[model samples]
Target: MNTTNNIVPAQVIALKKQRVILKTETNEVITVNVSKGKKKDKVFMLTMADLLRSGLWIPVNRTLRQLMRYDWLDTPVKSYAF
Candidate 1:
């Protein structure tokens, strides 16, 4: 996996079953898969924390920020073993 520390501002454009489509400041559209845990098990939605940890994208617009905030509040805590 190619991971980077650089994060770019983006706007959430669409939400799929286990993916999120975002439009970046440069007008680039990207589809990201939502997952969690060390194994990267798939999930149904995206969260701000997820985007941050991804190190690739960040929600920039007001609506997306609100949604990400809601997602952060609603997410359940889980323990992962290394």
Candidate 2:
């Protein structure tokens, strides 16, 4: 939410899910991991494109001070009333 910093988070692309393919900003495509996971074994299948577009790509450090700042809110569900 801070526009002062224009850095993207590493977590945006560092999730533990298998990547089907990777597309570079230059329009080059490559076959990458289908999912991202370290030796510990955890996988996430969430789509991160929206986050990337919003420029929230900054990586978050797992510190109590950082996590405690948030009150654990959820995004409102999108709707179509047409």
Residue-level lDDT of model 1, residues 1-82, one tens digit each, is 3223134467666666555677777886766655545125334243433654464545443332222433434456663234
Could you tell me every candidate's TM-score relative to the true structure? 0.40, 0.25
* Off by more than 4 A, model 1: 1-6, 36-82
Per-candidate Cα lDDT values, in order, are 0.50, 0.31
Top TM-score hit = 1
Give the clashing pairs for model 1: none
Task: Locate the minimum summed-lDDT window of 10 residues in model 1.
Answer: 61-70
Shift of residue 24 alpha carbon in model 1, Å:
0.4
Q: What C-alpha root-mean-square deviation, in Å, does candidate 2 show against the real structure?
A: 10.2
lDDT of 2 by residue, 1-82 (tens): 5532322123233323344233334333333343234222322233344433443422232221121112211233354244
